[model samples]
Target: MSDMLSIEQREQAWVFTLNRPEKMNALAPELVLALTEGIQAAHQQKIPLMIFKGNGKNFCAGFDFSDLDTASEGDLLQRIIQIEIMLDLLATSPSMTIALCHGRNFGAGVDIIAACKHRIAAAGTSFRFPGIKFGLILGTRRFQNIVGTQNALEILSSTRTFDAQEAQKIAFMQEIREPEQWPSLIEQAEQNNAILSDVTRRNLYKVLYCSAESDQNLAALVRSASAPGLKDRIRAYLKPN
Candidate 1:
């Protein structure tokens, strides 16, 4: 289990890194479960700073669809929605999550970063919303809040890749750095994470946004995601371009 994700905790900081460099550190069910448990551990340990990144060149390549078999499309979608809900608990934890993003961010990868309080990307990294091609929905509302409605629409709609410079221009990422400079840049990011007092900022989230309703609706829709022909469509879309 530790092989899937590595967690390091200190008095003030908790770092969770995706450990599978192969397959670009893709998210498997076990990895997602470990990440949820790690977030819980951070709360119990009173850690207020959280950093999410990858062990190698990529952040996360989204859900490991290869793990799915003949499960009902509904069952698979329910699992995906469950993963989303559980992952959100990390952001709502009594910590400030800052993503040090490099390489490619696709599908749920993008959603994870959007849910973070702050993000810094390496200049060489790229961002994309592949959900459009797959006929899936992503963090539209959260992304819109970060990068604005127009850009968010364009990003989600186009499914095209964008470099870090374009990402910063749209305010999707804060700072862009060369890979060599990420260590010092992340250290500085830790300083920013320290500003939040020892308390949950979830209230701030709910005050500015009422996402529960949308979440419920999304969960319901996603739970029933076993629409006829869904699997066929997914199989077709997943074929390498």
Candidate 2:
């Protein structure tokens, strides 16, 4: 209802679409709020699962850098808190949450996938966390949870581009396939409804998110700094002597 997120339920799953494709599905404050509201409402409705993907082209690129220019410190924190809330909801909700990512998924996109119970990318998708070049921050704290510490450091530090194959290999996504496979793939997710029990889900998440919230439970905390500092250091180190 925020005009930023579109929600629809089909069969047994609630589908949340990132609606800002013109901005490459960037996460703005209002959109974050919409996502939070949508997820909470769906859980209340007893929807068995939630699936996230983007409309238009790519799934999600990342946060809108332009929004940062005029946003207040409090507003920034609030938006991020909302995102954390969404991720937690996705992780611990009685329903199984999945990301059906396609096209370019970068920075915050990686963090988004980390929160879902399962993530899959279309073969056309490309995943990267190039926040190091920008002044943006993506998944640093939960980097280990998704890619493990070593690969996390390598990817975050190198800021390299990876495809769905590498993503699957790195454990960032469960499967990678053609866009045409979406129907069958989604059907597969729908079928999972039969095997998933809410009680089991609750217990599984209790163990998954030990510290309370799902993100915290998963320990997927972002690195403390969002502005640029290390980038400067790395640039300085790379500068001509």
**lDDT for model 1:** 0.74
Across 2-24, the per-residue lDDT of candidate 2 in tens digits comes to 88788887868878889997898
Full-model lDDT, candidate 2: 0.72
lDDT of 1 at 19: 91
- Badly placed stretches (over 4 Å) of model 1 are 68-71, 200-217, 220-224
Assess every candidate by TM-score: 0.87, 0.82
Model 1 — which ten-residue stretch has the worst lDDT? 217-226
Quantify all predictions' global Cα lDDT against the true fold.
0.74, 0.72
Against the true structure, whose lDDT is highest? 1
lDDT of 1 by residue, 118-175 (tens): 7889878898877656566646667788898888888788888988899899998988
For model 1, what is the error of residue 51's alpha carbon versus the real structure, in angstroms, after optimal superposition? 0.2
Q: How close is candidate 1 to the true structure, as a TM-score?
A: 0.87
